[model samples]
Target: MDLNVKITVLGAGAIGSLWAVALKQQQHDVQVWTRSSDSEYSVNYQDLNGNTHPLLFTANSVEHLSQSDLLLVTVKSFQVEVALAPIIKLIPNSCLIVIMHNGIGSHEAVKALFSNHCVFYATTSQAALKADAKLQHTGNGQTFIGSLFSANSSYNVLTEVFNQALSPCYWQDDIMEPLWKKLAINCAINPLTAIYQCTNGELANKNYQAQLIQVCNEVTLVMRAEGYRVKNDELYQQALTVINATADNYSSMNRDVFYQRPTEIDYITGYLIHRAKKFDIAVPVNTQLWQTIISMESSYHA
Candidate 1:
């Protein structure tokens, strides 16, 4: 609730545009940053309520070229490095940075870049899509912000700001809980959707149901072995609920494959495979799905 809190949102993608409008609605000093250029950019978005918002976001091409109280890293998972590398060394030691993106591992990378600053890993289920400068708000979901381990006073302040905005934002004392849960869900659903080029609802049919179960089972085993204490039956059921809830929606991976763009297969199922290796767990289903998506991505450029 600090008045006139300067907020710089990194990346001008779907989620980035969504947050820019949300923060702007709350009347905060806002700016958007993109690696391609270092100037103001126009962001247009349509919300879940069918409200279209268009605004010129004060933008910075270089991360270190501008200073803000809060720096939100909202770039695509794969583009994190290329976007932040030029300015990582220039980041102010006192700036608070939040890494908000799909998949895992990006947080560790960003934290390393801002080793001396206030850094946190955050995840949001709020789904949005972007094409050029246009953004479509697909679904409204909760966004949880958390530190690598525990939250502090600054966490509370940022959580309050997000809560006061349009979406429900919570501070997580143990971020690993949500992080693992999302990873498990993505492992079970994302790759298959990409390979099949189908919507979430399509996975419920007989053709894909068994495969879904197999992926979920493997993910459950890996998660339990990783010390999560999650049960296979419970995990499978939760995944089914997610599929049904987002039935008509095409997953990010699915869209990536359909559009011939690079997918985050490595971070989703690949992350599970990486963790399973540590436990010496056999995740055959996940492994196959991972390799399959990798093949799919290769076909794009070939």
Candidate 2:
């Protein structure tokens, strides 16, 4: 929680850049590691007063990332393994590795690689992006921090650190609940909105509304079969509320698909489809969405 604490942010993409700026604003010794070897990194950020601040920070390579108290991994879920491979040996055993990614399985992957170190999981509703080297914070939301299990001391310490660095740091007893909750939201809203190239509000149309409800219903059944308690109507309402709140902005999945880049479908809806197969459960709606997105990606490339 001290400003003297050295923090190294891995994967200086949109989310990572916003965090680096916020920590720097609080006077924390923060440095960002990116895939590129560029010396200067620029990010566009807006303060509480709605003033845009473009920050340019000195960039460092993986070789220069050894001197940090905490390492925040903000890479896309698919790139987590590759990004961490180069820097894992340089990280000291005392430092904590915080992973902020969508979907599941990231923590297990990191834990398997670094068996002796502390790894934490964090989820946030905060939305951000990079515009010509400027990291822009598009929307504000709360962030939850904790370990995989309950009654862990590391959860409290990490919660305090996040609270000092960002606003509304919530500590939960079971982090998986919120993680799955957010994943469910992404499963329903992301692919549908991306495929149609429409804002969240556009889902309110009668035709799209019926399709949205069906998707949520199928996902609800999958979650319940997995022994997770989630009401279909409640989750559907939450998804609709989020769509309305950020109705004007483009969902991240849409950006990826539009730019001919690989999306995180394998992590979001695909993760569920994988689990459903393991349990012999039916998830037709999710399966359809997953296949549709994959086909879209294939068509975009072809």
Candidate 3:
């Protein structure tokens, strides 16, 4: 595989747009395959240096997808199956598949669907948000990626490609640990932020401490039951670190609920609750948060 690979971003939201621009800047053949349009699209991006520019991308049609060397899926967790199902056959087996999203469990379906292909799961702390039609690059955090199906897959070429586009991207032998850890952080922050309708920093207040502790403890229990090495206090501390670091920001779930758009709750807390049931572990705190979010979504979606 070469460094300059033809890539198609499956979703053109903030993260997808960020990668599309980064890959294009690295001189990769990048196109965006979007649900809304088949025409050329442009992303209004604000780079880390406070530079604002328009990054244009061609529409990734079926023919373009067949020649694509990579398909980067950045849709919301619940949208993954639907978005990929329609184009699975169009994407060539030679194209690498990278699923990067907020929550987990969607990869299971993707693994089954693309069983023969090399599927990878990645977690990134790099933060980007859309504001008034422009994508803002906030945090330049490290990205960890690993193989989901092809354990013997060589990632040197892919790693280099990503590093050129975005520094500090590493390939991990076991991606699940980071995935679970990120899940713990999200479980502690996202839903609670939405439930309380507050910024991430507010969660650091003493009033929210008990809720945070219980959420982390529940998630830690499920994580341990699933055989991941984690501790309740560690998870809680990680969440607090993120909250304090991103004190002024509202979580993705908080924005989703505020805007009445679909959220990845089904994949975040919902996934945790499902696994807890499998292990017969009770996650009352998570269950409550999940139910509250579900109720809110239903009320608006109904």
Best by lDDT: 3
TM-score of 3: 0.96
Candidate 2 lDDT over residue span 1-302, tens digit each:
34466888888877898889988887877788888888767776775457888777767755446767889999989889999997789898877888898888666677788787777788998887676666667788889877773357644766776777678889876777788888888988889988998876787677888778888887787778878888659778988888888887777788888787888999899988887788888888889999999999999847
Q: What is the lDDT of residue 73 in candidate 3?
A: 94
Which ten residues in a row are the worst by lDDT in model 1?
58-67
Q: For model 1, how does the per-residue alpha-carbon lDDT over 203-277 read when each residue is reduced to its tens digit?
A: 778878788788888888877787788875877788888888889989988998999988887778888888889
Question: How does candidate 3 score on lDDT?
Answer: 0.88
True-structure lDDT of candidate 1: 0.80
Clashing pairs in 2: 42-133, 43-134, 43-135, 44-134, 44-135
Clashes of 2: 5
Sorting all predicted structures by TM-score, with the top scorer first, yields: 3, 2, 1
TM-score to true structure, per model? 0.93, 0.94, 0.96
Which candidate wins on TM-score? 3
**lDDT of each structure?**
0.80, 0.81, 0.88
lDDT tens digits, residues 1-302, model 3?
A: 78779999999888888888889999999999988765787878888899998877898577789899988999999999899998998988888899999988987789778976888888888888886568998778888889866574477788788888988998888888888889999999999999888999999999999999999999989999888878549999999999998888888999999999888998999999989999999999999999999999999957
Every model's Cα RMSD, please?
2.0, 1.8, 1.4
